[model samples]
Target chain A: MKELSLNILDIVENSTKAKAELVEIEIIEDKTTLTVRITDDGSGMSEETLLSVTDPFYTTRTTRKVGMGIPLFRLAAEQTGGSLTITSHHIDDYPEEHGTVVNASFDKSHIDFTPLGDIVSTITTLIQGHPDVDFKFTHTVDDSSVSLDTRELREVLDDIPLDNFEVLLWIKDNLIEQYNKIKYK
Target chain B: MKSLAELQAIKERMKNKIVLREGTGDIRVVVGMATCGIAAGARPVLAAFVEEVSNAGLNDKVTVSQTGCVGYCQLEPIVEIYEAGKDKVTYIHMTADKAKEVVEKHLKGGKIVAEYTVTDDN
Candidate 1:
């Protein structure tokens, strides 16, 4: 992916495929480091699956020979002298608390650091595609932060779908307004 | 800043429209959105479809969504359109611009853009 936002989208897609009902995406930008942490309450992976998740050749899919989501994400972070870490608890093992967490940290000073492009679009796209699923998104840069939680919107909208075009547009505009507040980073 | 008050107003406006759409059939526009598709630029394609469908005021009659890997890596960024009681039309290797045309032609005009559809080779 050309942008880190695209990688975020790809990883979250994996979460949804695993039957996650809630996904939380957090981006924290510090002085010289950038970190993206995605947590999902999905059917987590097995030990075998978790071990080979970063391997481009290993995939649960029988149709194709490779799965590139985690692998590419790892590459993107490593290219900037950063690292990617994933932890999961399968339902078979931890039935009460089964989910996955993906944390990738990057050295923003590195020349190869990828930019975060059009996160507003990513957020809106995720909501538009999966209106039933809930998402919590937060981006923190310096002293400024922006956040949105669908649960709140759900409380407000009793019968309306989250994918309603006007609602999605409102979300996009809200995100834009929030990003505009993060003037420094 | 976006406030809940504005959303409340939008909800009020949408109430009548929602009731009118209750019993009618809705078309489905599904886009491939796996790693291959994202790498091939399906994000923009999906976004374009959403915006175009909204702009054309077809939200009541159409729904746009995404799918996992289509298993055809070479045909990344594929899009499929399904109408009730009809065969699904699969469009391959789509871009943002192509998504708009597909919306206008196949979606709105009730005519398929055959050239963009997959054939035996594709």
Candidate 2:
């Protein structure tokens, strides 16, 4: 559960690093079959780069090894009786450019899905008011579905414009609090 | 399982005493939260800042925040202090202990810690 939130945060950081104008986030959970998945649209890696990212020493950013974040997410999912897959294209492949799609799946029965909703909410809230960027998040519980489109929310929601620094921390604090509040149940 | 009623109560309490009022003089303490910062133990540093500020009852005086990719991954746990009327002070490679000192010496005492400052000499 902790890894999931950290994964989302790490991917968003990657999106910003990629200078991506749009990112799509999707989460699906099923109680009966017990499955969960998270996918993202950010700078997709080249074939060589994609293969190397899974290596612990491989890193694209000078900040640190990318292996810790995404690799950890992949490990978490597999440890929970599931799997993770990543797909990406080289920069020259598309006219508009391409982004990476990281798909990590977990067995809901092995873990828990109650906290998943808050994860979706947290991601949406964190990406709020970044007009240049858009995220589409979808959540599924049992047979029920709740998806949020940030672009649509932009039209109806009064996005309290906040500077990057404090609001981001508040978002993290609130997300952790909310996740804890909902998790055990 | 937690109930929706509990969430509603949280919302009500939060709405009643929102600390983010218009006139409150906001002090922004920005922590570097990029990959380098995270790997170099910035999360604990960030948490220490928050805990100390809240514990000291200085929540109104200062607000702890985070920023991504400050472009100085070399200085992993970088912190930038932004006061309303003063030039920003950048502090690099901070630890939780150092962060607490920053809070006591700088935030509360209004005196910056020269050792951690990112001045030209240092």
Candidate 3:
């Protein structure tokens, strides 16, 4: 993807596709580096699949073999001399620990570093499409930060779905408001 | 920051109205969002559909959601619209602007935007 947030949106979909009940996304940025971690409580991949995820040709999908999500993410980081790592435990193996964690880091000092685009749109879009799944997102730049956890909202919403048009708009506005607070901090 | 307590206010407002999760919309708009689709700019298109659907007050009559690749990476950024009686209309290589037109013309007017539809079913 052209921007980091679009990649974030794409990777989170993989978690939801695995039927993840909860997805946690964390982005940490310091002077010269940026890191993103996405953890999902979904049906994780086997060790065999994990080894080949960085390979664009490796995919579990039956419809056409190539899966570019992970590969592209890896490329985005590595192209800046950074790194991507994935850890997964399939349900058939560790029933309790069956989930996936994808962590990628980027060298912000690099001239080719990809820009972080409209992340608020990415998070809200994911929620609108899959409101049933809970998402916990935190972004930290330097010491200032912003975070949101849908599980907390669920407690108040009760029966109201996150996909509700009003709720989704509120979420988008809320996220933008939070980001604005930290934008100059 | 917009606090959770504010959302509580919305919840209160929503409680007074009937929640309509059941008996879902008659029309469904599904956007393909796989790697190929995202690469081809499906995000803006999807966003436009959501905003326009809400703006048109069709939230009760139409549902917007996403799906994995339809096995047609060549036709990335595809959108499938399903209405009660009509056959599914697959629009390929769509954009945010095209999405708005589809919403106004096809969805609101009850006529498929044939120019945007995929020609070959194969």
Candidate 4:
């Protein structure tokens, strides 16, 4: 992907496809490194699926022969002197805690690291696209952090759809304000 | 920073407008966003539809959304449009510019841009 947020968008689509009810995305950026972690409560992958997920040619989709999300993300991380890891627990083996967690980190100052694109759009699009799924996003830069919980927003929204243009615009502005405070502080 | 109060005002104004559109079967625009699709630049295409739909104030009549792979990796960044009582139109190898044309020509002008469709190549 051209931007880190796009990568996040790509990965979370898998979580939604896995039938996850709740997906959590976290971004932590410090002076040295930038880390992204996405955790999902979905039908976790099998041990075999998890092992080969990083392979660009491996995909569970019957529609296509190649899955490039993980592999490309892994490459992006590795090229920046960082790493990517995926941990999953199959539902058959762990009924109570069945899901997948992907952790990718990149050196903060790496020349090849892509900029964090418009994350507010990325997040709001996902929330609007999958209204039934709850998403929690946490972004931390240095010592400050901002978090958004769609479950809580849903409680406040009540009947108004999240995809409403005005509501989505508000969300984008709010996220930008919060991220700016942390980023510029 | 925008306030929630603004959203509340919009919600109040939109409530009835939105309620009337329910079950009316609006036009649906689905962008492919699978691994291959994203790699082929589907994100901007999706964003363009959302933006153009809203900009044209056609949200009530048109809904923009996404889908996973559509079995055509070679035709990544594909877009499918469904209108009530009409067959689905699949556009292949789409870009944001092409998406804009689609929104303007097909969605707004009621004329499908035949040249950009998969059937055009065939």
Candidate 5:
């Protein structure tokens, strides 16, 4: 994807597909580096799958012959003098610890690194698209930070749907406002 | 910043309508969002569906969602529409504008825009 937010959206979809009930997405942007970390409580990958996940030709889906998400993400980070790491433990063996964690770091000022595009929209789309899953998003820029937890919102929402148009609008605005406050400070 | 109070008000006003939509929407709009789809710009198309569906007040009859892949990488950014009693209509090489048009003509007006469908050239 041309934008980092799009990449974030694509990567997180894997968590949902893995049947993850809870997903955490963290973004840390500092002076020289930008890091994105996604953790999920899902059916984790086996050692065999984990070993081949970085290959563009590897995919579990029958609909397609290739899975470019990880390979492309790895390329983006590596091109910027950064790195990507993925760690997963199979559910049967690790029960409580079974899940996946993807950490991708990039040189913040690298010329080839894409801009962090419309992250608010990305988060809201995930929330609306997967109403059953809970998401926690934490964005940190320098020393300031903000977090939004769907679990807390669910408590407040009571019977109301989180995907309600107005609710989504509020979420988008809230995220952008909070991120800007920290980024421009 | 937008207020949560505003959302609450919307919930109160549209509660009945929302219920009607959630349980029995007859039309489903699914966007392909796999790696190829994203690389070909499906995000904006999905966003357009969300915006137009809301703007046209068609949320009661149409549900917009996404799928992983449809096995047509060359036809990235595909959208499939399924009506309750009709066959699925697959539209390929979609853009945000085309998505808006599909929402207007096919979704709201009940007339499929044939030129945008995958079978048009076949």
Candidate 6:
């Protein structure tokens, strides 16, 4: 579960670095099923790159790929009696193009929600810090659901940058605050 | 829920003092923050730069920026230093402590710490 969140952080960082205008993250947790799906509108990879992504030693990134991120995600899902799948396409909805959707699933009954809040906080803070990027997060716990659209916050800012350190800290704190509101007693 | 008014106060304070001017500086410290960089502890290195610079009131003369990759995967937590008119100095296996020293000696005292620089051999 911990590695799962770390992988999500790494993948989301890639999305933002790709200059993605919009990024979507969905987490569904139920007693019997746990699923995490992250989609990005950033630059997609080629077929060759896609095949190499799962290899712990192969990565298109120039820096140390640690190449273990996606593999770790796959292992977490498989160990918990689930599977991981990925689909990539271009900007025009063509399968031959470049965008990516990585979906990993696990047995919810065996997972822990303690770390879920951290995952959400990481995403929210990254988005808040990088105001140039927009993030849409939808989280579901069994049947209860919550969604946060940064676009609305963007409207409040009139599209100005939210890179101020204090503002970014507030965003991170608020995400933790909101998560505690919904998850903890 | 913080608003632009708070940012305005920051801007006002910044206007009264010197601020960062991108791409035109005597020294530029670029931290590699791609996936590998993060895994290898680039975030702390980067954060230390910000903290140390702001603490020393050199945020104007020193600029810290993040770059995706420098094609040096083996050197994950790499930092590149470029002075006003000197050659680019690449430092490998950087820790937050070493970064602080770079700021003090190289940046403040104007001496190139060659031991930390990327060279043929240690």
Q: What is the C-alpha lDDT of each candidate?
A: 0.91, 0.62, 0.90, 0.86, 0.86, 0.68
Query: How high is the lDDT of residue A183 in model 3?
Result: 74
Model 1 docking grade:
medium
User: Which digits, one per residue and each the tens of the lDDT, describe model 1 over residues A41-105?
Assistant: 99999999899899999887778788899999999999999999999999899999999999999
Q: Which candidate has the highest DockQ of all?
A: 1
TM-scores for every predicted model: 0.96, 0.60, 0.96, 0.92, 0.94, 0.70
lDDT by residue (tens digit), candidate 4, A26-56: 9998888899999999999999989899988
Model 4 complex DockQ against the native? 0.58
lDDT of 6: 0.68
Number of backbone collisions per candidate = 0, 6, 0, 0, 0, 4
- How far out, in Å, is residue B87 in model 2? 8.7
Q: Against the true two-chain complex, what DockQ does each candidate achieve?
A: 0.77, 0.15, 0.71, 0.58, 0.59, 0.20
**Tens digit per residue, CA lDDT, model 3, A1-185:** 88999999999999999999999999999999999999999999988989988889998778889999999999999999999999998999989989999999999999889888988889988998899999999999899888889998899999888987788888988888888887733
Candidate 2 lDDT tens digits, A8-73: 656566665666666666666555343334334455677888887777688665644444666766
Instruction: Score residue A18 of candidate 1 by CA lDDT.
Output: 90
Candidate 6 ranges beyond 4 A from true positions: A1-3, A17-19, A29-34, A45-52, A56-58, A61-69, A92-98, A107-131, A138-149, A158-160, A180-185, B1-26, B71-74, B96-119
True contacts kept of each: 0.69, 0.06, 0.65, 0.50, 0.50, 0.13
Q: Write the per-residue lDDT of candidate 2 for residues B1-122, one digit (tens) a residue.
A: 23334434444544444646547646789888765666676766876787677677677678777787667777778999999889899999899999999999999889999899886654
Flag clash pairs in model 3: none
DockQ of 6: 0.20
Segments of candidate 3 deviating more than 4 angstroms: B19-24
What is the C-alpha lDDT profile of model 5 across B11-116, one tens digit per residue? 6776666566657678999999888888898888988998899899887778888898889888889999999879999999999999999999999998999988
**Candidate number of the best lDDT:** 1
| Chain B TM-score against the true chain B, each candidate | 0.93, 0.83, 0.89, 0.88, 0.88, 0.83
Clashing pairs in 5: none
- Arrange candidates by DockQ, descending: 1, 3, 5, 4, 6, 2
